[model samples]
Target: MATKPRMHLALDFSWTQVETDWRQPTSWVNRFYPDIGLFEDVARICERGLFDLIFFGDSTGIPNTWEGRIDAAVRRGVAWPRMDMSPWITAMSRVTSHVGFGLTYASTFMHPYYTARLLNALDHVTNGRIAFNVITSQRKADFQNYGYDELVEHGERYDRMEEFVDVCKKLWASVDPDAFVWDPVSGIVADPAKVRPINHVGRFFKVKGPLSVPPSPQGRPVLVQAGGSPRGVRASARFVDHVFGAGKGLALMAEQRVKLDEALRAEGRDPQQVGILWATKVIVAETEAEALRLKERLIADVPMEAVGAWLSHNTGFDMSTLPPRFSLRALNQRIVAANASPVGFVGLLAEQYGEDMEISRDEFFRHGLHAATGYASTKAGTPVQIADYLEEMFEATGSRGGFMLGHSQAGHRAVLQNITTMLVPALQRRGRMRTAYEGRTLRENLAAS
Candidate 1:
C-alpha cells in the first residue's frame, strides 16, 4: 500500500493570547505574561502533541499610528510590553526536546553578524531545533525606534533583506562545520586550515572575518521568511527553507503556491523541496456549537479604540482619520503611498470584499473588530470538523506544506489543550499526522515524509 500523505503542524504563539484575549475568563495570560513557567508549559504541551515548531513574531515599537499617539495602544496593551523572547525561548527549550523554536528579527534594522551569531548559539542551546525568521520591518513605529525618520522604501527593504541573508550565510559558512577538533594530546581546539575569514562587502552592509561562535548543530539555523508582496515573495524564494504565509482562503493560498514555485524555479531551486506553512487560526471544542460560542469571545468586550489602534498599527495607516465611507481600492492606494505594507489586513479585505466596493465607516469598524480580534479568519468546530477543514486546505494548497495554527484563540489553556489533546488525536487517527517524532533535528523533521 502507498504511504498516506501527512501534514506538518506548528503552533504560533506570537499573538495567540494577546489582543485582549488575556482578559478572557479562560485565559491565564493576564497572570502569566512574563512568567517563564507559562511558556515552559506551552512547550511541554506542543512537544506532547509532536508539533514541529513554536513560533514567536516580534516588533520593537509601540503603536502610535492610530491618532498619532501611543495612548490607545499602551492603555489597551495593543502591542506593548513585549519581551525580547530569546531568553524566554531558551527557557522553553530546556523543558522540551523535539519541538523547534522560531525566533524573529528584523533584517532591516538589525546587523547580520549579530543575528547570525545569536542564532548559532540558540541552535546549540535548542539542540538543533532553531529556525530563524527574518523580516523587513515595515512599520513606521519600528523605523522610528531604530533611528529612522521614515520607513525604508519597499523594494529596497527586500533588496537589503536578500543581501542580509547572503551575508549571514557566508558568516555561517566561514568556519567549516567540521572545523572543531578537540585534541587533548595535541592541545589544538580547532583545525587552523578549516577556519577562514568572510570578507563580505555588499549594497546593504560590509563585514569582515569569521563568526566567533562554533558551527551550530544544524550547520546553521533553518532559514524562514514571511514576505507576502511580490518583491517579498521573490526574496523568500532566494533563501528561505520554508515560508510563513497568510491563509486568506483556498484560492489565494493556491495562487501563492504557484507564484512561489515560479520564483523558486527562477532561483534554480527545487520548488518541491520548499514548503509554505500558512498562518492559520483554529479553535477546537467538544462540539461545533460549543466551539462557535468560544469563538465569539475573540471580539467580546474589545473596545473600538483598541480596534482602531490595532488596525492602524498593522496597516501603518491612521484609522482615526478614516473618511465616513471609502472604497478598499482607494484605501489600499493611500496605504501604499505612505510606503506601508500593501498586503496586510487592507489587502485581505480588498480580496474578500471587492476592492471597488465602498463601505461605511461603521461597516469598516465592524470588519476591523473582527480583523483586530482575529475573529474573521478563525475556524471553530469539533476536532473532526477542524481536521476536515485542515485536510481540505492541505490538499487544495498542493499538500507540500501544512498549517501554523494559532494567533486567534489559543491563548486560553482550555483552547490550547483542545488542540493538543483533541484536534491532534483526530488527525493522528486519520493517518494525517505523526504519532512520534522521526527526526532529531527540526530541519530533518520538516523534511520527513
Candidate 2:
C-alpha cells in the first residue's frame, strides 16, 4: 500500500497583485522584505501542517527577454521588478520556527567562497532550515558583471558547474561538523586538524579553501538543482537533494524519471534519496465548476509576451524566430537537435496558440507565465476531488510533490490560503501529506535517505 505522501509546500509568493481588479498593484513588493507579520502568518500555516519548507525563488539578472527592454516585463508583473531573495530569507527565519528557507544563487554568477559563506551563515541562523537552489541562468547581460562579454555555451557552463559543486562540497566537508568547541581555558576554538583547505583546481576554477564560513545545521543547506537538460540531470543526480522541473505530462514525467533513475544508478546513488518536485498550478473552489471559473479569472490578467519570452529563454532563442508553423522537429533541427523537450513544448504551444499570442510586444508580456509549462490542474467543489487530483498527479509523474503555485511576487496571501486551507487539508485527509513533522530541523523533515 502506498503510504501518505509528505509534501513540501513552498509558496512562490508572487510578490505582486494577481488579479486584474487594478485596485492593488505592487502587492509583491512586500515579499522582498516579507512584512514580518505576513511572513509569520505563512510560517504558522506551513508549520501547522508540518510542511517541509517554504522557500523563495530568485533570478540573478533582469527578466528583460522581449525586444531587450525591462518595460514589458515590469508592466505585466512578470519578474522584472523584484527584490533580492537573500535578505528576505532572514525574515523568514526570524518569523518561523520551522519551514526551511530555499534561497538561490547561480553557480555561474557567484564565486564559491562567497556563495558557501552566505549559505553557512543562513544555515546557522536558521538552525539548519536552509535549502539552496543552484542555477545557471539565461540572462546574457548577467555575464557583463561576471567579466564575460557573452554567456558561455550551455555545455561549457555546466561542465564548469560540475567543478563548482565539487569545490563547494569539498569546502563543506573539509570542515568537520564538530570542529568548533571554543575552549576558553585552553585558548582553542577550532582544531586546526579538523579545518583544512580544500585545494580545488578544475576546468572552470581553482580555490584553495578552507571555505571562509563555519559549518552549520544540515551540514550545508540541502542542495537543490533545477534544470531539465541531460547534463542537468546528470549533475543533479550526483549532488542535489531536490530537483525541480516542469513535468510536461504523466508520460513525459515518467520518461524523465527513467532517465533520472539511470543517472542515479550511474552515480551509485539510491534514486529514492533524490527528490523531484514538478511546477504546478491549482485552483480550488467549493465545487469543481467554481474552481474552473476561478482559473478563467486568473488567465485574464496575464501578459502573453512574457510567455513568449519565457519560451524563447527556455531554448535561448529569439521569440521573433518562432513562426506559426514552427514544428518541434524544425526547431530542434535549428539547434541541431541539441534542444531539450522544453523547447519542443514551446513549439507545441506556439503552434497551438500563436494567433492569440501575436499581439504587440507589450500586450503579450504578462499574458502567459500563468499558462503553465508544466501540469495544468484545477479542483473545484469539495476537498475529496482535490485530494484525488493530487494523488493522480503523484501517480502520473513519480514525483514526490508539485511546485503548486507561481507569480508569488504578485500575491502571497492567495497561495498561502490555497495550500493551508485547501491543498494541505485535502492531501492530509487522503494520507498523502505528513500529519506532523517527524524530525527536527528542515533537512530531517525534507531529506530522509
**Top candidate by TM-score:** 1
Model 2: how far residue 392 lies from native, Å: 1.7
Q: Provide the overall lDDT of each model, using Cα atoms, as 2-decimal numbers.
A: 0.89, 0.63
Residue 444, candidate 2: C-alpha displacement in angstroms? 0.4
lDDT of 1 by residue, 1-449 (tens): 67667889989888755677888876777777778888998999899988999999888899898898999989998887787889999999999989999999999999999999999999999999999999988777888998998777889989999999999999999999888889999999999799888999988899996999899889989999989899989999999999999989999999999999999999999998999898999999999999999999888889999999989888777889889999999998888888888897889989998899999889999999998888988999999999999999988888887889977856888788899999999999988899999999999999986
275-335 per-residue lDDT for model 2 (tens digits): 7776555655567676565555544534466566555544445554555444444555554
Instruction: Looking at model 2, report the run of 10 residues with the lowest lDDT sum.
Output: 15-24
C-alpha TM-score for every candidate: 0.98, 0.85
Error of 2 at 37 (Å): 4.7
How large is the C-alpha RMSD of every model relative to the true structure?
A: 1.0, 4.3
How many clashes does the backbone of model 2 have?
Answer: 32
